[model samples]
Target: MNPSEDQIYVIIFSTLFLGGLMSTFVVAMVFIHRQRQAQNKQKLDQIKSEHEKTLLNIENEIQQDTLTHVGRELHDNIGQLLSLAKLYLGSSKPEKQQEGKETINQVISEVRALSKNLNLDWVESLTIEEFIEQQLQKIESTGFCKTTFEHSIELGELPKDQKLVLIRVIQEILNNAMKHASPEEIKVKIWKDGATRTIQIKDNGKGFDTSIESSGSGMYNLKKRMETIGGDVSITSSIGNGTLIHLLLPN
Candidate 1:
Protein backbone atom coordinates (compact mmCIF):
# COMPACT_ATOMS: atom_id res chain seq x y z
CA MET A 1 0.00 0.00 0.00
CA ASN A 2 1.26 3.58 -0.73
CA PRO A 3 1.93 6.13 2.08
CA SER A 4 -0.78 8.70 2.77
CA GLU A 5 -0.21 12.49 2.46
CA ASP A 6 -0.23 13.14 6.25
CA GLN A 7 2.51 10.52 6.87
CA ILE A 8 4.75 12.03 4.13
CA TYR A 9 4.42 15.53 5.59
CA VAL A 10 5.37 14.31 9.11
CA ILE A 11 8.47 12.56 7.76
CA ILE A 12 9.74 15.67 5.90
CA PHE A 13 9.22 17.92 8.97
CA SER A 14 11.18 15.61 11.27
CA THR A 15 14.12 15.48 8.81
CA LEU A 16 14.30 19.31 8.62
CA PHE A 17 14.31 19.70 12.44
CA LEU A 18 17.22 17.25 12.91
CA GLY A 19 19.24 18.97 10.17
CA GLY A 20 18.78 22.36 11.90
CA LEU A 21 20.06 21.01 15.24
CA MET A 22 23.22 19.61 13.57
CA SER A 23 24.02 22.93 11.92
CA THR A 24 23.63 24.81 15.21
CA PHE A 25 26.05 22.42 17.02
CA VAL A 26 28.69 22.85 14.28
CA VAL A 27 28.48 26.65 14.48
CA ALA A 28 28.91 26.59 18.26
CA MET A 29 32.00 24.40 18.00
CA VAL A 30 33.64 26.71 15.47
CA PHE A 31 32.98 29.74 17.61
CA ILE A 32 34.52 28.14 20.71
CA HIS A 33 37.65 27.00 18.78
CA ARG A 34 38.33 30.46 17.39
CA GLN A 35 37.96 32.07 20.80
CA ARG A 36 40.54 29.70 22.33
CA GLN A 37 42.99 30.31 19.50
CA ALA A 38 42.79 34.09 20.08
CA GLN A 39 43.49 33.71 23.80
CA ASN A 40 46.55 31.57 23.10
CA LYS A 41 47.95 34.10 20.69
CA GLN A 42 47.55 36.90 23.20
CA LYS A 43 49.32 34.92 25.89
CA LEU A 44 52.24 34.18 23.58
CA ASP A 45 52.62 37.82 22.61
CA GLN A 46 52.72 38.91 26.25
CA ILE A 47 55.43 36.41 27.06
CA LYS A 48 57.53 37.58 24.14
CA SER A 49 57.21 41.17 25.29
CA GLU A 50 58.36 40.30 28.79
CA HIS A 51 61.36 38.39 27.52
CA GLU A 52 62.51 41.30 25.42
CA LYS A 53 62.18 43.73 28.30
CA THR A 54 64.33 41.59 30.58
CA LEU A 55 67.00 41.32 27.91
CA LEU A 56 67.10 45.05 27.44
CA ASN A 57 67.46 45.71 31.15
CA ILE A 58 70.37 43.30 31.39
CA GLU A 59 72.14 44.95 28.47
CA ASN A 60 71.86 48.33 30.14
CA GLU A 61 73.31 47.02 33.38
CA ILE A 62 76.26 45.49 31.55
CA GLN A 63 76.99 48.77 29.83
CA GLN A 64 76.90 50.68 33.07
CA ASP A 65 79.30 48.25 34.70
CA THR A 66 81.68 48.54 31.77
CA LEU A 67 81.68 52.30 32.05
CA THR A 68 82.44 52.16 35.74
CA HIS A 69 85.38 49.83 35.12
CA VAL A 70 86.75 52.08 32.41
CA GLY A 71 86.56 55.10 34.69
CA ARG A 72 88.52 53.35 37.43
CA GLU A 73 91.23 52.20 35.02
CA LEU A 74 91.66 55.66 33.63
CA HIS A 75 92.08 57.20 37.07
CA ASP A 76 94.08 54.51 38.83
CA ASN A 77 96.26 53.16 36.00
CA ILE A 78 96.49 55.39 32.93
CA GLY A 79 96.74 58.55 34.97
CA GLN A 80 99.74 57.19 36.86
CA LEU A 81 101.45 56.16 33.64
CA LEU A 82 100.95 59.60 32.11
CA SER A 83 102.39 61.28 35.20
CA LEU A 84 105.52 59.11 35.02
CA ALA A 85 105.94 59.76 31.31
CA LYS A 86 105.77 63.54 31.85
CA LEU A 87 108.40 63.31 34.58
CA TYR A 88 110.75 61.26 32.38
CA LEU A 89 110.35 63.53 29.33
CA GLY A 90 111.20 66.65 31.41
CA SER A 91 114.58 65.23 32.46
CA SER A 92 117.68 66.60 30.66
CA LYS A 93 119.18 63.19 29.73
CA PRO A 94 118.89 61.24 26.44
CA GLU A 95 118.23 58.01 28.38
CA LYS A 96 115.36 59.71 30.18
CA GLN A 97 113.88 60.87 26.86
CA GLN A 98 114.04 57.32 25.50
CA GLU A 99 112.23 56.02 28.58
CA GLY A 100 109.56 58.68 28.18
CA LYS A 101 108.98 57.68 24.55
CA GLU A 102 108.54 54.04 25.55
CA THR A 103 106.14 55.00 28.34
CA ILE A 104 104.09 57.17 25.96
CA ASN A 105 103.78 54.21 23.57
CA GLN A 106 102.56 52.09 26.46
CA VAL A 107 100.00 54.75 27.31
CA ILE A 108 98.70 54.73 23.74
CA SER A 109 98.30 50.93 23.80
CA GLU A 110 96.42 51.06 27.09
CA VAL A 111 94.09 53.74 25.80
CA ARG A 112 93.30 51.70 22.71
CA ALA A 113 92.47 48.67 24.83
CA LEU A 114 90.13 50.71 27.01
CA SER A 115 88.38 52.27 24.02
CA LYS A 116 87.17 48.85 22.92
CA ASN A 117 85.22 48.44 26.17
CA LEU A 118 83.40 51.75 25.84
CA ASN A 119 80.92 50.18 23.39
CA LEU A 120 78.95 46.95 23.68
CA ASP A 121 79.40 46.10 20.01
CA TRP A 122 82.64 44.37 21.01
CA VAL A 123 80.62 41.83 22.98
CA GLU A 124 79.18 40.47 19.75
CA SER A 125 82.59 39.49 18.50
CA LEU A 126 83.87 38.06 21.80
CA THR A 127 83.48 34.42 22.71
CA ILE A 128 82.51 33.19 26.16
CA GLU A 129 85.99 31.74 26.74
CA GLU A 130 87.66 35.04 25.98
CA PHE A 131 85.31 36.97 28.25
CA ILE A 132 85.90 34.60 31.15
CA GLU A 133 89.66 34.90 30.83
CA GLN A 134 89.45 38.67 30.73
CA GLN A 135 87.26 38.80 33.81
CA LEU A 136 89.55 36.46 35.73
CA GLN A 137 92.55 38.56 34.84
CA LYS A 138 90.84 41.68 36.08
CA ILE A 139 89.90 40.04 39.34
CA GLU A 140 93.42 38.83 39.87
CA SER A 141 94.85 42.24 39.14
CA THR A 142 92.80 43.76 41.94
CA GLY A 143 94.71 41.67 44.51
CA PHE A 144 91.43 40.78 46.16
CA CYS A 145 91.79 37.11 45.29
CA LYS A 146 93.60 34.59 43.10
CA THR A 147 91.66 33.33 40.08
CA THR A 148 91.92 30.38 37.71
CA PHE A 149 90.00 29.17 34.68
CA GLU A 150 89.90 25.74 33.04
CA HIS A 151 88.25 24.91 29.74
CA SER A 152 87.94 21.18 29.31
CA ILE A 153 85.54 21.31 26.40
CA GLU A 154 84.41 23.76 23.80
CA LEU A 155 80.78 24.81 23.40
CA GLY A 156 78.97 25.34 20.14
CA GLU A 157 78.03 28.86 19.10
CA LEU A 158 75.15 30.39 21.04
CA PRO A 159 72.51 32.93 20.10
CA LYS A 160 73.58 36.52 20.80
CA ASP A 161 70.88 37.03 23.41
CA GLN A 162 71.80 33.85 25.19
CA LYS A 163 75.49 34.77 25.12
CA LEU A 164 74.87 38.17 26.66
CA VAL A 165 72.71 36.70 29.37
CA LEU A 166 75.37 34.14 30.16
CA ILE A 167 78.04 36.81 30.44
CA ARG A 168 75.99 38.82 32.89
CA VAL A 169 75.16 35.76 34.92
CA ILE A 170 78.80 34.75 35.18
CA GLN A 171 79.82 38.26 36.16
CA GLU A 172 77.22 38.37 38.90
CA ILE A 173 78.35 35.08 40.34
CA LEU A 174 81.98 36.17 40.44
CA ASN A 175 81.12 39.52 41.94
CA ASN A 176 79.05 37.91 44.64
CA ALA A 177 81.80 35.51 45.51
CA MET A 178 84.31 38.27 45.88
CA LYS A 179 82.05 40.59 47.85
CA HIS A 180 80.38 38.07 50.13
CA ALA A 181 82.35 34.87 50.13
CA SER A 182 85.72 36.52 50.94
CA PRO A 183 87.40 33.58 49.33
CA GLU A 184 91.17 33.41 48.93
CA GLU A 185 90.79 31.70 45.57
CA ILE A 186 88.14 31.62 42.84
CA LYS A 187 88.02 29.06 40.03
CA VAL A 188 85.91 28.76 36.89
CA LYS A 189 85.59 25.68 34.72
CA ILE A 190 83.72 24.85 31.53
CA TRP A 191 82.84 21.46 30.09
CA LYS A 192 80.39 19.84 27.73
CA ASP A 193 78.80 16.43 27.32
CA GLY A 194 76.72 15.53 24.32
CA ALA A 195 74.10 18.29 24.04
CA THR A 196 74.67 19.80 27.48
CA ARG A 197 77.14 22.57 28.37
CA THR A 198 78.12 23.39 31.92
CA ILE A 199 79.99 26.24 33.64
CA GLN A 200 81.11 25.77 37.21
CA ILE A 201 82.36 28.56 39.48
CA LYS A 202 83.78 27.60 42.82
CA ASP A 203 85.09 29.69 45.70
CA ASN A 204 86.97 28.49 48.74
CA GLY A 205 85.26 30.93 51.03
CA LYS A 206 82.61 30.90 53.71
CA GLY A 207 79.51 29.18 52.37
CA PHE A 208 75.84 29.31 53.28
CA ASP A 209 73.26 26.58 53.48
CA THR A 210 71.33 26.19 50.23
CA SER A 211 68.27 25.04 52.14
CA ILE A 212 67.66 28.58 53.32
CA GLU A 213 66.03 30.87 50.82
CA SER A 214 67.64 34.00 52.25
CA SER A 215 71.19 32.76 51.99
CA GLY A 216 72.17 35.97 50.18
CA SER A 217 73.65 34.21 47.17
CA GLY A 218 70.90 35.77 45.07
CA MET A 219 70.28 32.28 43.75
CA TYR A 220 66.58 32.89 43.35
CA ASN A 221 67.09 35.85 41.03
CA LEU A 222 69.82 34.02 39.17
CA LYS A 223 67.61 30.98 38.66
CA LYS A 224 64.80 33.10 37.29
CA ARG A 225 67.15 34.84 34.89
CA MET A 226 68.50 31.51 33.69
CA GLU A 227 64.95 30.31 33.03
CA THR A 228 64.47 33.16 30.60
CA ILE A 229 67.29 31.74 28.50
CA GLY A 230 66.27 28.08 28.73
CA GLY A 231 69.10 27.36 31.16
CA ASP A 232 69.45 25.96 34.70
CA VAL A 233 71.32 27.14 37.81
CA SER A 234 72.29 24.93 40.72
CA ILE A 235 74.32 25.53 43.87
CA THR A 236 76.13 23.33 46.39
CA SER A 237 77.39 24.74 49.63
CA SER A 238 77.67 24.33 53.40
CA ILE A 239 78.41 26.60 56.30
CA GLY A 240 82.22 26.44 55.96
CA ASN A 241 82.94 24.13 53.03
CA GLY A 242 82.79 26.88 50.42
CA THR A 243 80.35 27.42 47.48
CA LEU A 244 80.03 25.85 44.06
CA ILE A 245 77.62 27.06 41.40
CA HIS A 246 76.79 25.20 38.22
CA LEU A 247 75.24 26.78 35.16
CA LEU A 248 73.75 24.39 32.63
CA LEU A 249 72.72 25.10 29.05
CA PRO A 250 71.43 23.10 26.14
CA ASN A 251 73.01 22.88 22.72
Candidate 2:
Protein backbone atom coordinates (compact mmCIF):
# COMPACT_ATOMS: atom_id res chain seq x y z
CA MET A 1 0.00 0.00 0.00
CA ASN A 2 3.07 2.36 0.31
CA PRO A 3 3.71 5.02 -2.43
CA SER A 4 6.44 4.47 -4.99
CA GLU A 5 9.95 5.96 -4.33
CA ASP A 6 9.57 8.51 -7.16
CA GLN A 7 6.22 9.72 -5.71
CA ILE A 8 7.78 10.11 -2.24
CA TYR A 9 10.70 12.20 -3.63
CA VAL A 10 8.27 14.50 -5.53
CA ILE A 11 6.22 15.03 -2.35
CA ILE A 12 9.38 15.91 -0.34
CA PHE A 13 10.56 18.46 -2.95
CA SER A 14 7.17 20.26 -3.05
CA THR A 15 6.97 20.44 0.74
CA LEU A 16 10.46 22.04 0.97
CA PHE A 17 9.65 24.58 -1.76
CA LEU A 18 6.43 25.75 -0.02
CA GLY A 19 8.24 26.17 3.32
CA GLY A 20 10.91 28.31 1.66
CA LEU A 21 8.27 30.58 0.13
CA MET A 22 6.57 31.06 3.53
CA SER A 23 9.88 32.05 5.16
CA THR A 24 10.61 34.58 2.40
CA PHE A 25 7.16 36.17 2.80
CA VAL A 26 7.63 36.48 6.56
CA VAL A 27 11.01 38.15 6.14
CA ALA A 28 9.52 40.67 3.70
CA MET A 29 6.71 41.53 6.10
CA VAL A 30 9.20 42.12 8.95
CA PHE A 31 11.29 44.40 6.76
CA ILE A 32 8.26 46.43 5.79
CA HIS A 33 7.11 46.78 9.39
CA ARG A 34 10.51 47.98 10.56
CA GLN A 35 10.71 50.50 7.73
CA ARG A 36 7.34 51.98 8.67
CA GLN A 37 8.34 52.19 12.35
CA ALA A 38 11.49 54.13 11.44
CA GLN A 39 9.52 56.54 9.33
CA ASN A 40 7.03 57.22 12.15
CA LYS A 41 9.85 57.82 14.63
CA GLN A 42 11.46 60.37 12.31
CA LYS A 43 8.19 62.24 11.93
CA LEU A 44 7.69 62.36 15.71
CA ASP A 45 11.22 63.69 16.22
CA GLN A 46 10.67 66.47 13.69
CA ILE A 47 7.45 67.51 15.43
CA LYS A 48 9.22 67.59 18.79
CA SER A 49 11.95 69.83 17.38
CA GLU A 50 9.40 72.23 15.92
CA HIS A 51 7.47 72.45 19.17
CA GLU A 52 10.62 73.26 21.11
CA LYS A 53 11.57 75.97 18.65
CA THR A 54 8.15 77.58 18.92
CA LEU A 55 8.36 77.54 22.72
CA LEU A 56 11.74 79.27 22.60
CA ASN A 57 10.35 82.00 20.36
CA ILE A 58 7.39 82.53 22.70
CA GLU A 59 9.70 82.90 25.69
CA ASN A 60 11.83 85.46 23.91
CA GLU A 61 8.83 87.50 22.78
CA ILE A 62 7.35 87.52 26.28
CA GLN A 63 10.61 88.70 27.78
CA GLN A 64 10.99 91.46 25.18
CA ASP A 65 7.43 92.69 25.72
CA THR A 66 7.97 92.76 29.46
CA LEU A 67 11.09 94.83 29.01
CA THR A 68 9.30 97.30 26.76
CA HIS A 69 6.45 97.67 29.24
CA VAL A 70 8.88 98.25 32.08
CA GLY A 71 10.69 100.91 30.08
CA ARG A 72 7.47 102.78 29.33
CA GLU A 73 6.36 102.76 32.97
CA LEU A 74 9.70 104.12 34.05
CA HIS A 75 9.62 106.99 31.57
CA ASP A 76 5.99 108.01 31.82
CA ASN A 77 4.79 107.25 35.35
CA ILE A 78 7.89 107.23 37.57
CA GLY A 79 9.70 110.02 35.74
CA GLN A 80 6.73 112.35 36.05
CA LEU A 81 6.35 111.55 39.70
CA LEU A 82 10.04 112.31 40.31
CA SER A 83 9.72 115.67 38.55
CA LEU A 84 6.67 116.59 40.60
CA ALA A 85 8.42 115.57 43.81
CA LYS A 86 11.39 117.76 42.98
CA LEU A 87 9.17 120.79 42.44
CA TYR A 88 7.31 120.19 45.68
CA LEU A 89 10.50 119.60 47.68
CA GLY A 90 12.04 122.87 46.36
CA SER A 91 9.17 124.89 47.97
CA SER A 92 9.77 126.42 51.40
CA LYS A 93 6.23 125.71 52.69
CA PRO A 94 5.89 122.83 55.19
CA GLU A 95 2.78 121.41 53.45
CA LYS A 96 4.55 121.28 50.08
CA GLN A 97 7.59 119.57 51.57
CA GLN A 98 5.39 116.96 53.23
CA GLU A 99 3.63 116.36 49.88
CA GLY A 100 7.03 115.72 48.29
CA LYS A 101 7.86 113.02 50.84
CA GLU A 102 4.57 111.23 50.15
CA THR A 103 5.16 111.47 46.40
CA ILE A 104 8.61 109.93 46.78
CA ASN A 105 7.11 107.04 48.73
CA GLN A 106 4.54 106.52 45.94
CA VAL A 107 7.34 106.44 43.37
CA ILE A 108 9.20 103.82 45.39
CA SER A 109 6.12 101.63 45.58
CA GLU A 110 5.49 101.89 41.85
CA VAL A 111 9.10 101.02 41.06
CA ARG A 112 8.93 97.93 43.25
CA ALA A 113 5.77 96.76 41.48
CA LEU A 114 7.43 97.17 38.08
CA SER A 115 10.54 95.33 39.22
CA LYS A 116 8.59 92.10 39.77
CA ASN A 117 7.55 92.07 36.09
CA LEU A 118 11.13 92.42 34.81
CA ASN A 119 11.62 88.64 35.05
CA LEU A 120 9.44 85.79 33.74
CA ASP A 121 9.93 83.64 36.81
CA TRP A 122 6.67 85.03 38.15
CA VAL A 123 4.78 83.50 35.25
CA GLU A 124 5.59 80.05 36.54
CA SER A 125 3.54 80.61 39.65
CA LEU A 126 0.78 82.70 38.11
CA THR A 127 -2.44 81.04 37.00
CA ILE A 128 -4.16 81.78 33.73
CA GLU A 129 -7.15 83.42 35.39
CA GLU A 130 -4.89 85.76 37.37
CA PHE A 131 -3.08 86.89 34.25
CA ILE A 132 -6.33 87.74 32.51
CA GLU A 133 -7.53 89.77 35.48
CA GLN A 134 -4.29 91.70 35.68
CA GLN A 135 -4.45 92.56 31.96
CA LEU A 136 -8.05 93.70 32.33
CA GLN A 137 -7.11 95.96 35.20
CA LYS A 138 -4.37 97.52 33.14
CA ILE A 139 -6.80 98.27 30.34
CA GLU A 140 -9.27 99.87 32.73
CA SER A 141 -6.52 101.92 34.34
CA THR A 142 -5.67 103.39 30.93
CA GLY A 143 -9.19 104.92 30.72
CA PHE A 144 -9.24 103.91 27.08
CA CYS A 145 -11.97 101.32 27.67
CA LYS A 146 -14.13 99.63 30.29
CA THR A 147 -13.16 96.03 31.03
CA THR A 148 -15.14 93.13 32.46
CA PHE A 149 -14.06 89.65 33.52
CA GLU A 150 -16.39 86.75 34.29
CA HIS A 151 -15.49 83.25 35.34
CA SER A 152 -17.72 80.43 36.50
CA ILE A 153 -14.96 78.51 38.23
CA GLU A 154 -11.22 78.13 38.20
CA LEU A 155 -10.06 77.06 34.75
CA GLY A 156 -7.76 74.10 34.62
CA GLU A 157 -4.02 74.69 34.56
CA LEU A 158 -1.46 73.99 31.85
CA PRO A 159 2.26 73.34 31.83
CA LYS A 160 4.52 76.34 32.17
CA ASP A 161 5.44 76.42 28.48
CA GLN A 162 1.84 76.16 27.33
CA LYS A 163 0.83 78.77 29.88
CA LEU A 164 3.36 81.23 28.47
CA VAL A 165 2.11 80.71 24.94
CA LEU A 166 -1.47 81.27 25.99
CA ILE A 167 -0.51 84.37 27.92
CA ARG A 168 1.26 85.93 24.93
CA VAL A 169 -1.59 85.07 22.62
CA ILE A 170 -4.13 86.67 24.95
CA GLN A 171 -1.98 89.76 25.33
CA GLU A 172 -1.77 90.14 21.56
CA ILE A 173 -5.53 89.78 21.22
CA LEU A 174 -6.19 92.48 23.82
CA ASN A 175 -3.62 94.77 22.27
CA ASN A 176 -5.22 94.31 18.87
CA ALA A 177 -8.55 95.30 20.32
CA MET A 178 -7.11 98.49 21.77
CA LYS A 179 -5.07 99.40 18.70
CA HIS A 180 -7.59 98.55 15.98
CA ALA A 181 -11.00 98.00 17.52
CA SER A 182 -11.11 101.00 19.88
CA PRO A 183 -14.06 99.36 21.54
CA GLU A 184 -15.86 100.91 24.49
CA GLU A 185 -16.13 97.60 26.30
CA ILE A 186 -13.70 94.70 26.47
CA LYS A 187 -15.02 91.65 28.29
CA VAL A 188 -13.27 88.38 29.09
CA LYS A 189 -14.82 85.17 30.38
CA ILE A 190 -13.50 81.79 31.48
CA TRP A 191 -15.34 78.52 32.09
CA LYS A 192 -15.24 74.79 31.60
CA ASP A 193 -17.31 73.26 28.84
CA GLY A 194 -17.36 69.48 28.97
CA ALA A 195 -13.78 68.39 28.39
CA THR A 196 -12.61 71.82 27.29
CA ARG A 197 -11.60 74.96 29.16
CA THR A 198 -12.65 78.08 27.30
CA ILE A 199 -11.41 81.66 27.48
CA GLN A 200 -13.63 84.11 25.66
CA ILE A 201 -12.76 87.71 24.85
CA LYS A 202 -15.46 90.00 23.53
CA ASP A 203 -15.07 93.58 22.38
CA ASN A 204 -17.75 95.92 21.11
CA GLY A 205 -15.52 97.34 18.40
CA LYS A 206 -15.67 97.67 14.66
CA GLY A 207 -15.35 94.14 13.38
CA PHE A 208 -14.15 92.86 10.02
CA ASP A 209 -15.67 90.37 7.62
CA THR A 210 -14.73 86.78 8.30
CA SER A 211 -15.48 85.61 4.77
CA ILE A 212 -12.69 87.62 3.21
CA GLU A 213 -9.22 86.40 3.91
CA SER A 214 -6.97 88.88 5.66
CA SER A 215 -3.74 90.00 3.99
CA GLY A 216 -2.02 89.75 7.32
CA SER A 217 -0.64 86.55 8.83
CA GLY A 218 -1.68 87.38 12.39
CA MET A 219 -4.68 85.09 12.56
CA TYR A 220 -2.87 82.27 10.82
CA ASN A 221 -0.02 82.50 13.29
CA LEU A 222 -2.42 82.46 16.20
CA LYS A 223 -4.07 79.28 14.96
CA LYS A 224 -0.74 77.60 14.48
CA ARG A 225 0.35 78.60 17.98
CA MET A 226 -2.75 77.04 19.49
CA GLU A 227 -2.15 73.87 17.51
CA THR A 228 1.32 73.60 18.98
CA ILE A 229 -0.17 73.43 22.46
CA GLY A 230 -2.96 71.00 21.47
CA GLY A 231 -5.47 73.84 21.69
CA ASP A 232 -7.52 75.95 19.28
CA VAL A 233 -8.53 79.58 18.54
CA SER A 234 -11.90 80.58 17.14
CA ILE A 235 -12.86 84.09 16.13
CA THR A 236 -16.32 85.38 15.15
CA SER A 237 -16.89 88.87 13.88
CA SER A 238 -18.93 91.02 11.50
CA ILE A 239 -18.59 94.56 10.26
CA GLY A 240 -20.07 97.26 12.56
CA ASN A 241 -20.73 94.56 15.14
CA GLY A 242 -18.04 93.25 17.46
CA THR A 243 -15.33 90.60 17.67
CA LEU A 244 -15.41 87.52 19.84
CA ILE A 245 -12.43 85.24 20.28
CA HIS A 246 -12.48 81.89 22.00
CA LEU A 247 -9.30 80.22 23.15
CA LEU A 248 -9.96 76.56 23.89
CA LEU A 249 -7.72 74.13 25.72
CA PRO A 250 -8.32 70.47 26.47
CA ASN A 251 -8.94 69.38 30.01
Best of the candidates, TM-score = 2
Residues 1-251, candidate 1: write the lDDT tens digits: 35787788888988998899899999999999999999999998987887798799889999999899899999999999999999999999999999999999999999999999888887788889999999999899999999999999876577888888899999999988888789999999999877788999999999988888875547887887788888999999998989999999855
Q: Compared to the true structure, candidate 1 yields what TM-score?
A: 0.80
Q: Pick by lDDT: which candidate is best? A: 2
> Against the hidden true structure, what lDDT does model 1 obtain?
0.89
Error of 1 at 38 (Å): 2.6
Off by over 4 Å in 2: 1-21, 89-98
lDDT of 2 by residue, 68-187 (tens): 989999999999999999999999999999999999999999999999988888898799889999999999998999999999978656788789889989998999899889899999
The local distance difference test score of model 2 is 0.91
